[model samples]
Target: MSAKTKYTDEPIGPVKVIPDFLPPPEELVFKEDTVKVTIALSRESVEFFKREARKHDTQYQKMIRRLLDAYAVAHSKAKQNEITAKRPARRR
Candidate 1:
């Protein structure tokens, strides 16, 4: 075992204000109504989410819900785009 090393006093550089380039956090939120339903899953599947949830410190049910929500949103957008593509373009 070695003793802790001592450090000489060092000065920090002056701080400069940087422009904020990220979007506001509020923009990311959209409330959605939810319904509760009972469902069954394989032990392996539940275990996987539970393990992942533990690592991230969140409920497995919430993670599963978000995954389903994202899937539905993506598929809905793709379907909308496909339908739009099939319609004739309007004259300017």
Candidate 2:
């Protein structure tokens, strides 16, 4: 038997679900240097980011850029360490 059937014999009626929509305010203009990026994500994660971005009054792309920059710095440091480790030991 399915888990739903095991848990409850009756069907659950209309669970109040929240709609995922953001109404942008008027007079919003993006700068010329700004570039648009489309990232593929699961529906839930996208909604989470959208909510967080709305809370901060900043675009999701800006938040993603900041995160990417931090990730890049850490990744570069790890790569540098790996390169250094591969070098042969020098004798005096």
lDDT of each: 0.84, 0.71
Question: Model 1, range 34-75, lDDT digits (tens) per residue?
Answer: 899999989999999999999999999988987887678777
What candidate 1 gets wrong by more than 4 Å, as runs, is 1-24, 27-31
- Tens digits of per-residue lDDT for model 2, 1-92: 66563565788888998653332455235442556777787888768778899999989766766567567767797899999999999999
Most lDDT-accurate candidate: 1
Can you give the lDDT of residue 27 in candidate 1?
40
